[model samples]
Target: MYLIAGLQPPMDMRLFLHGFQDFFPSKAWQRTPVLYLPLVAFGRMTPMAWEELDQSLYTLHLPTPVTLRHTGFDVTLKRNRIILEATMEASVIDHLSVKIRNLAQRAGVSATRSLLPSGIPLADITDVDPSVCNLWLATHRHRFASTEEVCEFTVFKTGKNRENTFQEVMSDYQFADLFTPPSELL
Candidate 1:
């Protein structure tokens, strides 16, 4: 199943930190809230590349899309929502329902006071049509003269029509980062 979660801004990173644990309770025993890389990979990362990866993982205010791996899920955070692809089985869906509820309840704690439960509630989530992204790419790929132009369009359109402003800063830097080929980042 594909899912989309519409999140609002001024976000507290701890919400996600705790939400990750909530989603995979079994992994809670091993939780360190840290992602480890092999020494060889760590040594090979250029300062800039390391900084880019660090920002993607640690920053809560990022406007560009980024994917972070949790215990059993790969969550892609975009300007408007968090996206995930998972099984549509009844058990998995039930687990999701419980996890989101647990996370929402935790959001009310003083430590996560900046977060709004409504912003992360089930009401804001929807089952996604996976092909929408593919259809979007197919329709728009030919419209731009260059990849950079396509990226610029992507950045500019993010969260612009939403009732709430999520991004405080928009920059040319995001245009390049968002569309850079994955191979180039490694």
Candidate 2:
């Protein structure tokens, strides 16, 4: 978990029309182990521009700050055996996959491993509607012990009108391996 320093530029629709040219790295980017979250109000002004994303994460809040219960890391240690598993929320499946792909390309793991989103269980999965999808990061072996792996998902919004539920939502951002410890992307 990382602290969101501050959003440099207030969210603007201009970000969508242009690629990542406008996104100057927020102060959060410079921090070590940057799992940095963005300010909630920043997410309200714009929606996720999936097409323009590169090596960063976009975020929004629904009045209520999204709470994350660290179920644990992607690595599991059992009998000196390290097992890696990444489980994503149902709504974030697509974006998470993109980050995984980007990290795979940069990390050179694309060819060796098959990054996939499985276990279609709806329990932990909830519709994060009105709560926009923004926030990116890479999940890779370098972040874990030598014996680990990963799986992921995108949390989705439910069918109910969530306008009243969430106050704001983030647009998007790229999750990267570098965000993982030990500076994997480095």
Candidate 3:
């Protein structure tokens, strides 16, 4: 696990991405590994924008290549975006869930025994003007409470909308259900 100095609870424990586009890298784009920095320092950092998270934290290098496939999840690349659909097997989910639980424990937060969806989707377009057909980054907030403390997980998604502007797309919550469990199906 990657650890940074001075990173406090909640704020410190987040999945930071770098050199990624629409949850997957393009053929010409080099893959930058995702870092799990649970106890890093965030005092010297400021959030300029969602796409600029690399500026806030120090990146750690691992011995092996880290990808979503390593965690036993299936990733599909579509025409303009990447999709990550979870499997029903508990082992696969536990692989990622364990990391989250460990982070929460280090932060002193009492997290539930379950793993909530924290899938992130990102998009990068180079050929078009962003103002007209821009890519939008959306975040979903999840609040988990126990008898003592409350833990919040902010999941992110990125998409392109031709019909709506960047501001309008960012303000939309119609796709928020993607991160939530389906009551009818469950």
All models: lDDT?
0.26, 0.24, 0.26
| Candidate 3 stretches greater than 4 Å from native | 1-63, 69-93, 116-186
Point out where model 2 deviates above 4 Å. Answer: 1-89, 110-114, 120-186
Q: How far is candidate 1 from the true structure (C-alpha RMSD, Å)?
A: 19.3
Question: What lDDT tens digits, residue by residue, belong to model 3 across residues 10-129?
Answer: 222222233223344234322322322111211222233322333211122222212222122233343554443221222233343454334434444332243233332223233334
Q: What TM-score, to 2 decimals, does candidate 3 have?
A: 0.20
Question: For candidate 2, what is the total of clashing residue pairs?
Answer: 43
Give the Å error, residue 39, model 3. Answer: 17
Q: For model 3, give the 10-residue run with minimal summed lDDT.
A: 167-176
Candidate 2 CA-lDDT value: 0.24
Best by TM-score: 3
**Estimated TM-score for each candidate:** 0.17, 0.19, 0.20
Over 59-141, each residue of candidate 1 has an lDDT whose tens digit, in order, gives: 22223333222222222443565433211112122232233334423433111111121111111122344464344334433
